[model samples]
Target: MRAHGDFSRTADRTPGMTVLTVDLVHHPAHSVLTLHGELDFASSDRVPPLIDAVVKAGRRRLVVDTVGLTFCDSRGLRALIHAERALAALGGGMELVNVHGRLLRLLDITGLTGVLAITTGPGAGQAVRK
Candidate 1:
């Protein structure tokens, strides 16, 4: 299978916060985005456009790994929700993986734990063979 990722070095400054750095893997079945840094008002706006571009290209399922993600505000959550809805409308879905600590709680409090197609890991949602 063919897959691609967007990796970057160095930080881009925008006013007070550094922009969220996203590493994306575009695959035939799905797109995997490994997000680093913070997703707040300053950088949360960076996500949807990218997700839209992916969706527009016909990739449906989206798996977002929040392992490297540090901080996320309301704006970030909004961006995620928008992407989820965008994908849902296309008959696709979104998943969250490697979530822990406050981020997990945040998703629960915001009710995204139910909204997002969450998994324990990349393969957790898949049925295991004995």
Candidate 2:
């Protein structure tokens, strides 16, 4: 996963402060990319490269796991929309998992709840192991 506009490095150059941790993960299944992160301005820029890489990798379906995300801003929401559009252009699709709290509310308020497929809780759509 590529991290763009990471303030962690800039913070290091300054001083005094300790450190802020931003974690991101990309789980590519058959044709999906599951993401877990804060999804704020600090990490929003990272979404594009991930999408690009996935497209280049020839994946069609994208599933984003938002279960671990604690927060998200408008920019972050836009990133998801942009990803969906990009995938659509390639005749692919995207889905979101573990939507809850502020993230769910944001989607509702922005009228995206109906536009995106959102699964909730731990067992919303778990895959069975063989």
Candidate 3:
């Protein structure tokens, strides 16, 4: 557990570079990881450690809030899948919320709409297949 919030630090970046910022928010029932910026190859690797930290802190259920997520490539998708599997292996679960636009379409096109537990729209909670 690295404090109660902002689990990952803001990495130093050069001009015109995009970076991912992951914030940890603990809810009564689960932990929420808020992702911001592009989730491409360079930033995808940042997710796993945070997931591990959350699990290490005794959290099982995790909700990945993509409200601020601007982009997600295949590697980003892989990171998400890995997180879901890692949680499931520990008798836990993970879900995505606020997914829309290209990311949603990618999931749908890749058949991940059925593979990953995701919820869309305002105030989403319950998981639904696309």
TM-score of each: 0.77, 0.73, 0.82
Model 1 gets an lDDT of: 0.73
Instruction: Show where candidate 2 strays beyond 4 Å.
Output: 1-29, 121-123, 127-130
Minimal lDDT window, size 10, model 2 = 17-26
Among the numbered candidates, top lDDT falls to 3
Model 2 residue pairs with clashes: none
What local distance difference test score does each model get? 0.73, 0.66, 0.79
Tens-digit lDDT track for model 1 on 1-130? 2233333222654456444678666776787777877877767777877787677667888888887778788988998899888889888888877776778889889888877877665565241110
Please give the RMSD to the true structure for each candidate, in Å.
Answer: 4.6, 4.8, 4.4
lDDT digits (tens) for residues 61-128 of candidate 3: 88888877888899999999999999999999899998988889999999998989888876674422
lDDT (Cα, tens digit) per residue for candidate 2, span 26-56: 3454244444445666567777777887777
Error of model 1, residue 117, in angstroms: 1.6
- Which parts of model 1 are misplaced by more than 4 Å? 1-19, 121-130
Candidate 1 vs 3: which has more lDDT: 3
- Residue-pair clashes per prediction, in order, are 0, 0, 0
- Give the clash count for model 2: 0
Query: Which candidate ranks first by TM-score, i.e. highest?
Result: 3
Weakest ten-residue segment in model 1 by summed lDDT = 1-10
